[model samples]
Target chain A: MEQILRYRVQNDFSALSRFLEELRGLPGYARLNERQAYRLGLVLEEMISNIIKYGYDDSKVHEIEVVIRWGDMKITVELSDDGHPFDPMRHHCPGSNSAEPLEQRPIGGLGIHLARQMSEEMTYRRENGRNILQIQIGGGVAGD
Target chain B: MEIGFEMKDKMTIVHLQGRLDAETSPAAESQLLPRLSASGGNWLVDLKDLEFISSAGLRVFLMLAKRARECGTKLTLCSLRPGVRNVFEISGFCTIFAIEDSPAGI
Candidate 1:
């Protein structure tokens, strides 16, 4: 089975909520034991939030274009936004392991790291003044 | 996001439900951080019903843990669903925070 969702959502939390609900309502989403589906939601939410929070230079509301392809074996997410040009894949500090002491660790950056770690694969690009991120989760696997 | 504060015996248990993401984390931090500093540093957060947690949510928990250590109080997170637990595992947080099967098991 295959499903695709393409929609433009405002930079708001309600948009994130609405997108999640749509993902949950897919044809075979419920049959797959929501954990994998929830992983999709979490990855999408984190990536989009970063675009909305840091991608824009001004406070003006922008539309983030999201394309989700729900396939039989895996789920692919392609998120594009008209915010600033930044690559979530390359901008953050590299080689920061999760083994740092709690006191020495920074509170931030873990979100993007989690988004990177959970997905089976992820790619980022900057094209035509937009930031694009693609993420893949749940590759022929059920549950955690 | 909904947070309920419960006084269980001598420990303060913070009950969290719904999604703890970028949108709801600031409020969660404001409500959760102050209590950890009030001399009772021993804390238990019940995350059984917390369906989703983003990195923003991790920051709140991390902040609480860092502060609790300075104050010499313990923080135990219990009843985490597998999905939520996976977030902790990947982040290597299992080594930093005390996690148990249930609040009673803690």
Candidate 2:
């Protein structure tokens, strides 16, 4: 059996708050084990915040779509937005500079990296002025 | 997430309570950055109560670390929960911050 939860949100942080509530309350979210749930939440927040912050050139409002599909084997999340076509995966993960010590390491450059690191697989596509991202994670449905 | 600040023996101790992901990081950044700028003293971050963190939170600590280095100040992160520590280790942040097993040693 397959189960899904979908959300349509404005390009505002307030929308994110509501979306998070729904995600947490999703029927089977509790059975996903702690790590997978955390990943889903982290990816959702990171991607949507990027869209809300950089998705538009003007102050006008826009909408973003989030869909989560889960079953016994794996969980998949899809995010689509009507904003500019920016691929989160294109950015490189600059290696942390452990040699120079913590103080010298750069401040930025970890959001997309963590998103990539968390998901087992990810794909991105652009069409008709919309950007879509899909990610797959987890193994068997057994609780941890 | 709640953020508390205290001065302990020349170290500016920034104690984080609760998750430090995207949702809470903005609040954390707004509260912590100003203090970070004014602080050239050593830093001991107490993360015993923090259970989660994402890149957004990582960026905040990194900013402080980089700035402190530029200012020749000291920074240390201590008492991370296993889950939060994994986020840092996964992001390779474990190597980027001076980490200790407990806050008492710092």
Candidate 3:
């Protein structure tokens, strides 16, 4: 069996927060520790925010599909967006390992790099004109 | 996430409650940056109620600290939760920044 939650909302930030809260209550997410859960929420928010701001080019409404599955020892979260197909993993992350001053440095594309650093395994692919990204989280008790 | 401010003479105290993820970090950054300009050499960040934080959230802290340093003000974090503390340790921020178990100690 699989758990799925789909959302269609305006390019608003509140919708992302509500979607993350829903994931926190899922059975599959119950196994993750606070750190993993928080990281997962951050990754999801960053991806969604990028799509909302840059993917749709200010489109009024965007649809996102989130599918979660509980494996024997791992939890998989897949997020698919119908906005533009952009792979964040390949984006150039500014201020990466730099000693530049904060005001001088631009806040460019660091979210994706941060997400990759926190997740145990992360993959991104474009399928059916949608960006499909999956993350595997473990290192906790088994799901009840 | 809820952010409350307390003015301690010239020092500013920011209390962060709830989870500070990518979504909430921007709010923190926006609220904290402008306050740093008037800080009289000290800013205390109270994270006692913060249950969890990710890299995205941590970035906000780093940015604040960097800005404070440039302005000759100090940014100190107090009362970090265990999970949030672990993120600091992993990021090697524990040594670079001043962190205490409680605000009273800071």
Candidate 4:
């Protein structure tokens, strides 16, 4: 058996913690402690913020959808937004990772990079003109 | 997130408690920057009570730090929880900003 929790909220950042906090009461959540919860929260927040700030730049109406399902060994999270389409997985940092001057190096692209560092697997797709992001959390993965 | 500010001697410390995720980031940016700008002293961010912070929160900090540098003031971060510290370290912000493990040493 699996558990799923779904939520929809405005395209804002203040509602993110409250949205993610509702998942703490699930059965499998007992296996994932506060540190794991914090990682999930961080990644989800980064994705949501990017969607609202850059995807929906015109401040139009939009909805954010989050779904989490847990099994015996893995936790799956799906975050979808009905705003403009943004595939953060495709973004690449423009710097050479050199010790060059700060002004000459690029400043952006840290969000997706951090997500890649935290999650076991991350996937992005655009279906029906909506940005959909999927991430999986496994029990075997060590905490960063 | 609830934000409280305190001024001690020549430095202003901003205590950020709770989650500094995407939604609460803008409110923090709007509230914290103006105060930091108006004050004539350096800023030390106390994140001891902060349970979580995302890249959006990091973005706000970077922007505020950049603004502070441009205005000839210093911005420092102290007392980061383990979760928040990992985000900061993973994002390479520890190199970009001044960070300390404890407020007592700063």
Q: Which tens-of-lDDT digit does each residue in A1-144 have in candidate 3? A: 445445554467787777777778877677656555666665667667777778786646777777666544555778788888888778876645445545565544556665666667888999889888888766455422
Q: Between prediction 1 and prediction 2, which has the larger DockQ?
A: 1
Q: Chain A only: TM-score of every candidate? A: 0.84, 0.87, 0.77, 0.77
Tell me the native contact fraction for each prediction.
0.74, 0.50, 0.21, 0.48
For each candidate in turn, the TM-score is 0.87, 0.83, 0.77, 0.78
Task: Give the CA lDDT, 0 to 100, for residue A63 in model 3.
Answer: 76
Docking class of 3: acceptable
Residue B28 lDDT, candidate 2, scale 0-100:
83
Per-residue CA lDDT of candidate 4, range B61-98, in tens? 87777778877888889998888888887776777778
lDDT of 2 by residue, B19-56 (tens): 78767788888787677778878888999998778788
Candidate 2 regions off by >4 Å? A25-27, A93-106, A139-144, B36-41
Candidate 4: list runs displaced more than 4 Å: A8-18, A21-31, A52-65, A80-86, A93-109, A125-132, A139-144
- Candidate 2 docks at the CAPRI level of acceptable
The clash numbers for all candidates, in the given order, read 0, 0, 0, 4
Error of 1 at B3 (Å): 2.3
In order, what lDDT does every prediction score?
A: 0.81, 0.80, 0.72, 0.74
Which one wins by DockQ: 2 or 4? Answer: 2
The best candidate by DockQ is 1
Candidate 3 chain B has its poorest 10 consecutive residues by lDDT at B87-96
Better of 1 and 3 by lDDT: 1
Clashes of 4: 4
lDDT per residue for candidate 3 within B1-106, as digits (tens), equals: 8989888877789888988775678888888788787666588999999977765677787778777888898888999887778667655567658998898986
